[model samples]
Target: MEAVMSLLVGCFFAAGVYLMLSKAIIRILIGIVLFGNAVNLLIFTAGRITREAPPVIAPDMDRLTGIAANPLPQALILTAIVISFSFFAFLLVLALRTYQELGSDNTVQMRVAEPEGDTLPPLGY
Candidate 1:
């Protein structure tokens, strides 16, 4: 199972990078999402997948007796999910605004600071 999951994570990362390298803004956005999911899955796999009991102890016991599921990774993944979602949302909005204003979604064509056919500015020391 771990091996399968590892392979899946690798594939996600590969696909994400491939998409991110595209000139299209939409593909980059999707790549970012896939990258975020890959990270989350990586965290989960590192936490050790099992059917063990939850991380908790009886009132009488001071420490956990048996192998219990780790909660740290779960918590971290949850936080990451929320953060990634908000970041994606912000990027989507920004991309939409850029597309609306520039009428293009290609990074190469969305040149605002240094447009084509313009003379290069002089370099200052």
Candidate 2:
């Protein structure tokens, strides 16, 4: 099970990186999401895979009876998820604004908006 999970994590990371290097804005967004999932998987694996063990302490179960997966990674993942979600939302809004202003999603063609003329009218003349 560990081996399988490790392989899956590796694949997801690879896919995410592959998408991240693309020139398309949407692909980059997808890559970011994929990378987040890969990170979550890596943390989950670090917590150690286990069968049927609850992380919470219970009076009925002895410590020796079953080894539980660490809860710390889950909590970490949850916090990371929330932060990443906000980042993703912000990125989407930013991207939309970029598209609206630039009129293109191609990274190569996109340019920062610049005022056409260099000279400006005197402020208080």
Candidate 3:
């Protein structure tokens, strides 16, 4: 199971990178989302999946007796998910605004600072 999950995570990362390298803004946003998901899955797999009991100790016992699921990774992943979601939303809005103003999502065509056919600025100090 772990092996299969690891393979899936690798594939997600590869696909995310491929999408991110594209010139389209939408693809970049999607790639960012996919990469975030891949990271979450990677963290989950690293936490070690087990069929053991939850991480709780009996009232009488001072420490957990048998196996207990690690809680740190789950917490971290949850936090990452929330943060990623908020960031993705912000990026999406920004992309939409850019598209509205520029009428294009291509990185090359959105070069307002350096319009096509313009002479290069001087580089002297």
Candidate 4:
């Protein structure tokens, strides 16, 4: 199972990077989402995959006696999910606004700040 998850994580990272390299804003957004998921999975896998009991101890026991699933990765992944969602939302809104203002989502065409035919600045001050 760990091997499978590792493979999947690798695939996700690859796809995310591939998509991020595209010129389209939407593709980049998707890539970011994928990348976030990949990171979460990586954290989860690093925590060790096991079928042990939950990380809880009985009141009568002095401490946990057997192997228990690690809770840190789960907590981290949950927090990361929320953060990534908000980040993705913000980026989506920003992309929409840029599209509205420029009427294009392609980075190559969205060049209002630096129009073509402008004289190049002096090579040296």
Residue 51 deviation, candidate 1, in Å? 0.8
> What does each candidate score in C-alpha RMSD?
2.5, 5.2, 2.1, 2.1
Tens-place lDDT per residue, model 2, 3-74, is: 888998999999999998999899999999989998988998888877756666668866546566677988
Q: Which stretches of candidate 3 lie over 4 Å from their true place?
A: 117-125
- By lDDT, the better pick of 2 and 3 is 3
Q: Which is the winner by TM-score between candidate 1 and candidate 2?
A: 1
Q: Pick the candidate with the highest lDDT.
A: 4
In Å, residue 110's CA in model 2 sits off its true spot by 0.7
Q: Evaluated with TM-score, which candidate comes out highest?
A: 3
What is the lDDT for 97 in model 3?
100
Query: What does candidate 4's lDDT look like per residue over 4-106, in tens digits?
Result: 9999999999999999999999999999999999999999999998898998989999899998999999999999999999999999999999999999999
Which should have the higher lDDT, number 2 or number 4? 4
Runs off by more than 4 Å, candidate 1: 117-125
lDDT values for all models: 0.96, 0.84, 0.96, 0.97
Model 4 score (lDDT): 0.97
How far does residue 13 in candidate 3 sit from its true spot (Å)? Answer: 0.3
Query: What's each prediction's TM-score?
Result: 0.90, 0.78, 0.91, 0.91
List where candidate 2 sits over 4 angstroms from the true fold.
58-66, 113-125
TM-score of 2: 0.78
Worst 10 residues of 4 by lDDT: 112-121
